[model samples]
Target: MTPTQRHRVLALTPYARLLSVWQTLGIHTDHRCVRGPDTGMAMVRGRMGGSGNAFNLGEMTVTRASVVLEDGSLGHGWVAGRNKPQAELIALIDACARQQAWARRIDSELVEPLAEALEEERQQASQAAAATRVDFFTMVRGE
Candidate 1:
């Protein structure tokens, strides 16, 4: 899968859902940490109006982890928060996705469902907001 698609899967998926999907796939993952479930600050860079010179916005807390599967596939997961378990799980899923044997199943079962759920959640939020929306127009007064 393309990097963008993979990024979406990792970013939007909740920790519980990932665990559930792993169980549903019926494939056990026994992984050893190749790097870390380490948390650190990553410098954030930004540009003004999307065209200005890049400037350091600030440091954001990011957690990253790497895992090596028993079958020799490598995966790394990074997320924008301090949740180590989430990062580790994402890394494992990514490692599985990298292996050709597991790629299709990962995309079909894990990524697709997570994407759908994210979309549905967004839709619900939008509808709820819409329900509260008010439109005002001037009305003519008859004397």
Candidate 2:
């Protein structure tokens, strides 16, 4: 997958799940964090009806980290929340994803499962919403 898609999956995958997958893969690589797993607030904005004037949604907690692998590949992770370890691990994984030696394994082992799980969750939510949908019909009045 492209880097954008890879990063999106990394951001969405839960810390626990990602950690489990990492352990299961049994990967050990040397890396150093160059930036923080620092927590801060980011302003969220939204558009009314998806196209109307934009308005502030509010601020959300964000944690970001950056890492460089031994092979000199760099990665950055930005996730919503205050989970520092999760942010660091995401950065490491992102670095691995950029490396030629690790890219295939990272994609197949880590990213694919996470993406599938995300898609499954999306499908379930859609089904739930569909169940609550209402249909309306009106009859024309006689002239």
Candidate 3:
């Protein structure tokens, strides 16, 4: 593949990583729920705080991207938020799906680093939270 093709393939690694992590954790963000062209806009209905009756959250703008490979194959990706990476991933995955030759380059250079970075960030956040942990105790009263 040419340098441009390589770069394009590389660019999609993070999106794959993000999707993988999101799926692994079972986080119910709009990223995983919606699909297709209408993915960018969905009338999500859910309880505000798990107490009140269900309500429509109205139409929220989302991001959806697709890539068409040289061989006329397509791969699609989407996320609820306006995260650029999510859109880019969708496009790249589409490209990769269409052009299987680019898959190895994308997986090694792009996907691996994206996953590593995310894992590192998660670890740091967890450590930070752990550091601030507090202990509580109660004293017995004598009658």
For TM-score, the strongest prediction is 2
> Judged by lDDT, which candidate is best?
2
Pairs of residues clashing in candidate 1: none
lDDT (10s digit) by residue, model 1, range 43-136 = 9999987899999999999999999999877788888889998888888888878888888988888788888888999999999999999998
Q: Rank the candidates by TM-score, best first.
A: 2, 1, 3
**Can you tell me which runs of candidate 1 are displaced by over 4 Å?**
132-134
Clashing pairs in 3: 75-94
Q: Alpha carbon lDDT of residue 4, candidate 3?
A: 44
lDDT of 2: 0.90
User: What's the TM-score of every candidate structure?
Assistant: 0.86, 0.89, 0.53
Question: 7-93, model 3: which lDDT tens digit per residue?
Answer: 343343455555674345332212231233434576788896977889997887666666554455555655566675666555555
Alpha-carbon error at 68 in model 1, in Å? 1.4
Kindly provide the TM-score of model 2 when superposed on the true structure, using C-alpha atoms. Answer: 0.89
Q: Count the backbone clashes (under 3 Å) in each candidate.
A: 0, 0, 1
Residue by residue across 10-120, what tens digits does model 2's lDDT show?
889889998999889888989999899799999999999989999999999999999988777889989999999988998898888887888899999989999999999
* lDDT of candidates 1 onward, in order: 0.85, 0.90, 0.56
